[model samples]
Target: MPITEKEVRKIAQLARISIDDKDICSYEDQLNKILAFVDEMKAVETEGIIPLAHPSEETQKLRSDKVSEKNQRESYQSVAPTTENGLYLVPQVIE
Candidate 1:
């Protein structure tokens, strides 16, 4: 389907774009080429190829689930400028 100026205008309006007369011609050619590419792609035959997330044939490494030592919060909070009841104090930024 060839992209029309009217269709471009309608799409631009929907997208809140401000395309002028000079840019419309350039955009029209671009859109027509993209539509032509899609038209060509529709002719290809794909019978058995499966669509996949990753193109490579490799499995991800698995890790064994085990309980680990938790991080020491008291040690980490020592770096903060101010702390009260295990909470970091921050300056008020909002009204």
Candidate 2:
């Protein structure tokens, strides 16, 4: 369907985009072309085709779920300026 100038203005308003008076016709033409392409795509036959998330049939590979690092809280706290009972100390800013 060919888009009208009024419809294009409404679209620009809804999308919060600025459109010049000279560019309105250009935008309307582009939008009409896109609508025509969508209309053409709707006419294509897909009666038995199953919908899929991916284009390829192969599944993605994943690594094994396991813990690779040990907890070193004491070691990390040793490098801090002030630490007590495995916790870092910071100055109070708010009353």
Candidate 3:
């Protein structure tokens, strides 16, 4: 069904938009055209069409998961002000 000007105004009001009087007709026309296009699309036939995640059939190149850096925990903790059981101590700010 085609959208009416009154319905367009109501939609604008509900969406908290301030549309001009002349623009209501334009909005109504655009909305009606969209609905007509949707009606046309509904008539298309699609019996066994499968949906796809991507349009192209290319595979993504991936790298192997491996450790590339050496451990520096001891070197970092040596410079800390307070560390107990390999954990840094901080002043409590909340009660």
Per-residue lDDT of candidate 1, residues 55-85 (tens digit):
8788888877975869789999999999999
| Clash pairs detected, candidate 1 | none
RMSD (CA, Å), each prediction: 9.2, 11.5, 13.1
Ranking by TM-score: 2, 1, 3
**Candidate 2 at residue 55, lDDT?**
88
- By lDDT rank, best first, the candidates go 1, 2, 3
Structural similarity to truth (TM-score) of each candidate: 0.44, 0.45, 0.43
What would the per-residue lDDT of candidate 3 be over residues 3-59, giving only the tens digit for each residue? 888899888989999899988888888899888888886687877888676888888
lDDT of 1 at 14: 100
| Model 3 whole-model lDDT (C-alpha atoms) | 0.87
List the candidate 2 regions with Cα displacement exceeding 4 Å: 45-95
Output the worst ten-in-a-row residue range by lDDT, candidate 2.
51-60
Q: Cα miss at 17, model 2 (Å)?
A: 0.6
**How high is the CA lDDT of each candidate model?**
0.89, 0.88, 0.87
